[model samples]
Target: MSGPRGSLVGQQLRVATTRFAHGGHAVARDDDGRVVFVRHALPAEVVQVRVTRGKAGDRFVFADVEAVETANPHRVTPPCQYAGPGGCGGCDLQHADLGYQRELKAQVVAEQLSRLAGIERDVLVEPVPGDVDGLRWRTRVEFAVDREGRAGLRPFHTRDVLPIDDCLIAAEPIIDSGVLRRRWPAQRAVDVIAPSGSGSAADSESDPGSDPGSHPGSPAAVLVPVPGGVKQAPEVTEHVASGPWSGDITVDARGFWQVHPGAASTFLDHVLGELDPQPGERALDLYAGVGLFARALADLVGDEGAVLAVESDERAVVAGERDTARVEQLEWRAERVEQALEPLIDGGDEVDLVVLDPPRAGAGAPVIRQIAQLSPRAIAYVACDPAALARDLATLADAGYELDTLRAFDAFPMTHHVECIAICRPSSAIRG
Candidate 1:
């Protein structure tokens, strides 16, 4: 049962308990009061392990479950191979059951409420779900071709590159394309863009010094299937391909975008379903990207309803305005959300619905307070990271808003990334 005499430095151990950490990692504690953050571990399992990152005063162990010593019903075989150690940060649920993933996401929401927002509820909106096939759905990938010119993602928890022959999450271009197969020890990293939707990748306008988007003819675009069924632009012939999570629908190769093309539709549909925009309503879309939600809301509002789409990115605002020119009900504005709302503070424009699609850092305190001051009847918050969402929710709740509906979209299936939506309203509307 012992492999070399596990010295005091190499104490043999078992994972005493495991708990969910933000970004889907499982934090386990060992007998030595040292923490063994075994990726994808479940609670109550005794695991055999080695130490990867540790110090003399404290010990951290790494476990290779040679045997389950004990098992939890919540554990399941991971759906993706890169889900565990030495795997992509894309997914952390290989050892966790799917049902549990849903619950865990929901729990993270609930915990955020009590711990951050302070509105403990018996139930939350049923978490939106779809079948697996997590990786293959990604419509865009920005590969890092190291100085060696091999393309792939940064290694888990480090900057080292893992030269990949194929990425399960990447679209067809990244897989079969000759970009990664070539050699280029001359450069540090190069990006490869893939096409989204039914269109071919558009030629890229790249900065000369950048890696993947370095050339003007780079074929790539992060596909964004706008809600209520907006088709890809027919004349749009160019796309700037860049990196994962960076180029979903940006004019340039680098900007924040919702990753995972495979799950983009399912995720968008879920958000639309939850928001359920009504006609003749005035809506405010904050942090609005190249008008994804703005255009979608435009369709629902029709001629009678109006949507004010606000985005910080001047490029995205211009793109969204141009992209959704057909929608008369939408007005796109390029301005930081916090400053843009200054006029509304005095009760000038009271919107029926307010949607916040903030970055991982989330809406800071000022933004949260303004949302409350504006007092929109319904606020749909699309958050890419849970912890940030939780922190913001706490701020909103303290202002007397309650979480009416909360749902999670598994847009990034293989990686550790998860997106969530929270619908908040006055406590009077609290169902239970």
Candidate 2:
């Protein structure tokens, strides 16, 4: 094999994978004692690696397993054929068993906390309710369109699209939608969503007391990104019947919604329990996408209390406004979180509780300091990335806040992504 510059890419070396690292690679050391992150390999396994990218002065290089001379017991054949080296990058930890995957994720979380925050805690990753052996639980998926109009996924770290008949990790509705078989010449990417009540195999066993009759009206919503913007397909209403709040959330087929079938309810229940908002308290829901958390906050605080939701996305804000319109106590602000937080903090309104579900970037230190200034009795942070969460938590620590409770969930099975819910309180309160 040759590299991009006609350089030899088949340079092989033997190394034993020591442990799992963030972003799906397993840690190993090269002959020169430099770190080598090997793909398609597992911990404690002896593998011959083909260097993908690296040079002498570099701190680390990346490689793919040429041959697994020794395999770990926890290693399993990835369910998806396009999951190994030079395959789809959608699911990284599929090579490991489901239980081992969670353990690896917990280890990554603990390492990030200890390294970044100088704090350590027992990390437990609870499984979300749905998923048949972690095979088909993704309610949303995006496929890349190749030049020939073939709909497929991009290979690991490359723009090249690999066509396939079906994605095993996709929910039943998405797989049955026949999206992979379709052509999208004019589109760069296509998004598929399996809203609630789609009757997918994962949703076969409905929760007790859930209105099983509420259908999603469509098996899956297919959206295509066009030249001007995203061309919307049919809209889908996601029904939620979970702790404290239950209703139908209307979202544009292309809008942001939890991809996991059980994530919305699971995170909501956990956050509500952690915050334990009291009636007549003022709350702020930052990065409130479609008002999922804001609606629940409004219910917890009641009519006497007030909840403000801030979001930068115009479409999401418009949808959030419509969804929470009946709740007079909740108001949606279509502005960036950092921009809106300053004025609210300066307004002298006492914020009792704040729930922020930021993007993968996580809320930076500036935003965390502003939130600390609000002096909310309790703050709930929902994070999709552990490293970003750890950095922000360290920043909050500098502002005199202590991490009270933290919980991690296996929201994205078969992938390295894990969701964390962190509760923080003033250090004085902890000392009191």
Candidate 2 ranges beyond 4 A from true positions: 1-10, 197-229, 232-234
Best by TM-score: 2
Where in model 1 is the C-alpha error above 4 Å? 1-14, 32-35, 50-83, 87-89, 95-100, 121-132, 198-254, 262-264, 267-276, 326-328
Best by lDDT: 2
lDDT of 1: 0.61
Worst lDDT window (10 residues) for model 1?
A: 237-246
Candidate 1, residues 1-432, lDDT tens digits: the string is 323444333445566555655555456776557666665566666666555445455455454343466777887776555456565554566567555666666666556656766567543323223333444555446555565555566655677777766666565555554555555444445444454532333332222233332223434433221122323322222222221111224343334455454344544565566667888988888998766666666777779999988888886787677766777899987889988889888756677788888888999888999888877778888888777887888788788787777766666554446677788888777754
- For model 2, state the Cα shift of residue 201 in Å: 21
- Over 277-377, each residue of candidate 2 has an lDDT whose tens digit, in order, gives 88999999999888788888898899999999998888888877887778899998999998998887789656999999999988999999999999899
TM-score, prediction 2: 0.91
Computed on alpha carbons, the lDDT of every model, listed in order, comes to 0.61, 0.82
